[model samples]
Target: MTKLETAFAPVAPAVDLDAYFARIGYDGPREPTLAVLRAIHQKHPDAIPFENIDVLLGRPISLDPAAIDAKLIGAGRGGYCYEQNGLLKRVLAALGFQVEGRMARVLWMAPAGAPPRPRSHMVLAVRVPGDDAAWLADVGFGGCVLTAPLALFSDDVQATPNGDFRILPIDELGGERQVQADLSGRWSPTYQVASGAWADVDYEQANFYTYAHPSSHFTFSLTAGRTTPTARYALKNNRLTHRDATGALVDQRDLSAAELEAVLRDVIGLPVEPDWRPLLEKIVAWGSAA
Candidate 1:
């Protein structure tokens, strides 16, 4: 093992190669190279969706590596940032890539001039082999996730299967940056990232606030996203929104409980247990009441 591996050997979850490869439908190279990084970035999100099912079900979302593997990789369940990014970290590390833990403030949904949002969102800073600069990679953003890795440098438009993406420098002096998605000639800010070496406790605290806080939207509503080469789709509460390859919002509609179940099972390819459907009924009823 390398020095980095020796240091992380204890904390990193042992990845089940068979299971993870199957989950992402990727059977290609796992070298610590840019090509592998981009391929994994594209395929991983296409397979494991960005979802908050546990939070919506009023259950505590576990950030423990083993628990994440059991729920996401083993059982094929999806998760929010803390869980989803956590899994990606392990997989990349197990594949021999140097992955750093970082946190970002979610500014996309924030109101202008509002107090700065917490650095709650987690991201991976990767050191791909044969590359001079590190790369920013994430698979946990439920609304707009990058289907390709972006260079850490700023302002250049990066291409992804989902859309044209970029991370523009917001405060060059302060090293603050924002990720943007190009949608029909409009650049939509996804989130702002600041410089910080995020620690494990930071992620735990963020997960607590996002998953357990009564005021958090994840606690009361559902948010799920899936990406494909042809389209990207999101489920927010009862609303299902679809965007085509060009980043044009193609479809938006409310889903009935039965329809929601079908989307979960078919569109997202989640194996929704029979009993889970009843809980979904409650969720739909609760949404209507809300």
Candidate 2:
């Protein structure tokens, strides 16, 4: 087997369930019910955060369960989608929930008339024991992240802790769906999710591109986001922004080098490495020019 395949080999939950629960500060029911999923969906991002620091640091993103557990759970660091959702997949599976991986073409900030982007974003389709219908769960969408799973079979608007969301079918057969969120009275297309089976190799390939491709935004930018019950915090380069639960901007500011480090460590709750000082300086300088 290839390295990626081996790293992703199916095994009993490699992540310690207790460690994961503690990492997210979740003490709710362990059952694979919608309530438990919702509780975790909200708590995961709030505690673990979403970040691309490893990509910016030129580190290969690993899908090995041990590595994910060590970095995100044990080491007090955050990661982008693959790590975030991949870990969630294992945890949910360990909890006896049926989980499937899915990919999406991100349209969150795509300019008008831009060519269709690749399917680079990762999400989950989950099935509870008693429910026949599936739900969409994703905790790695950065600033506008979802705090609850959206029903896969419904086109109706679903309410989450972050904001209201709707899953719109793109075709008559429902082979594809568009994920939209209500943003300040406007329903914006966040991404188009494809109804297809996804494998570990697919995630590894997409992760490789995200961390290594020059065109990938994760490789060039510094981004960290955390969603709390009251507000959502986003840090891009050196700009720190806060938006209330209603998607209204609360405040935004450019940070200096010291302030940038402080925000990453304190506000975002990332273990900002001392070795990242130089890179943090560059981020601050770029933010000033932008």
Candidate 3:
């Protein structure tokens, strides 16, 4: 099968279910229904952090399932969007969620007057059993990702444990929906998404550009993210930010080497790979990241 056809092609739920469930510390039902979806969604970010350490180090990321599993699940490391969502796609399909791989154009960090960012982001269009409406589930986006799947409605307010998220229809192109996020109360253009049945090759190309190109922020900055029931925590470079229930900044500070290391290990649950220990120190060390 071509990569596009295999991107999220539902064949059989034969993925290692027991291992995935164990990884997420989820003891919930796996009945291929929306309830299971919600249970899995809520537990994922709590267990797996969103990070891009390998990319920043110029390690060639392979989208191969085995590589993703080994790095993220086996190595106790975290990954950025593609790795996170790619792993989720397999797990959701293995559970019979009828999920498809999708792409989005990011605008969250676009420079003013700069063209819309590339369709570098990955999203999932899921068909929940017994529901007429499809839902958008993304466990990848770092800054303000969906902690729970949102019903794919343009104006409906969806509540998540971390914050309120609502999608607004911006423009439609060739039957695809253009949506933006209403994070807290601010409006920011998100990405234009489609059923996006292209190829794993397409995703790999985008992932390559982000990590290989100098202009891409992921190539240079250090970032990590995790969401809890009460708040969201994000660490970019050496600056750490914590937002409360209302998406208000509860804490923001430049973390010292000790402090940043603690947050990465304890809060984000990512252990330093022995080879990257020195790099990690220099990246988060006082005054060096600046």
Candidate 4:
């Protein structure tokens, strides 16, 4: 078997590549660049959950393509960017797209007009046929990420059911790229991209830090998320918040352990293992104490 196939060979819940494609609403021949992005986004808020369950359980996050495939495709789990986007790079390459794995420093909106800080994030640069340039596609970020690939230079408005988004060039970092969204006209910073090339091993080390570091948010919160056509659901620590299409706060609640697990399985569609319960309890207790 090829390296890519072997990597995903152990994927459980059986990916059913055809069914998975159908699940994502794609029924056409592969477009290489477009198909991979669409599948990830459509499957994303469904298949891979946005959760930090593994970290709270003391499990190491693996950046291996096969390992990620097993966790996400086999076990029906969701992961953060390193795991989500890393595996996506492999899938795109396997499908014959011109794929480059790139890293980004996250510079989201801060409280006091401080400069955007760097957080380890990953995205893909895909070159498509009949197109002179590549596009930026990200399906891994929990919230406020793109559902479709955007042209690199054009300032076109790509409208999602939720809101409008645009990609613009950042000259401060020597022609680096930044993705901005209409956060009520505030133009919030989502992520910063550059022309740097990255490899699987590079992401492996970064994933280790985010999952294991005391300062990383994953170490403290039990979070899971998925995006819907009209709203976004996220479980952060003990509070569950739902945001509507106009970026309005729709609902919020505190969940018990059983409720959390049910949401993980039923709402996010991820398979919950028996061991995850104890971790969930610990997270709940931690939240209650804090």
**Per-model lDDT:** 0.83, 0.91, 0.77, 0.71
* TM-score to true structure, per model: 0.91, 0.94, 0.88, 0.83
Cα deviation of 167, candidate 4, in Å: 2.1
Which numbered prediction scores highest in lDDT against the true structure?
2
- Across 167-206, the per-residue lDDT of candidate 3 in tens digits comes to 7655554546655555557756666676456455578888
Instruction: Return the top candidate by TM-score.
Output: 2
Q: Which rank order by lDDT, best down to worst?
A: 2, 1, 3, 4
Task: List model 2 lDDT by residue over 1-290, tens digit each.
Answer: 99999997766456698999999999889999989999999999999999998888789999888999999999999999999999999999889898889999999988899999999999999999987899999999999899999998699999998889999989758589999999889999999999876876679888889899999989888889998899999999999999999889999999999999998998899998899999999888878787
Error of 4 at 205 (Å): 1.9
Question: Candidate 1: lDDT of 219?
Answer: 83
Error of 2 at 159 (Å): 0.8
Candidate 3's displacement at residue 219, Å, is 1.1
Clashing pairs in 3: 4-198, 4-199
Instruction: Write candidate 1's Cα lDDT for 1-290 as tens digits.
Output: 99989987656668787798898899998788888989999898889998887776667998888898899888988988888888888888888888888888886666778987667789888886555687899998986888888887757898888889888888878888888888799888888877766765668777899988887778878888898888888887767899997788899987888999999888877888787776688767766776
Clash totals for all models, in order? Answer: 0, 0, 2, 2
Off by over 4 Å in 2: 1-12
Candidate 2 TM-score versus the reference? 0.94
List model 4 lDDT by residue over 207-246, tens digit each.
8889998978889887678777677777777677777775
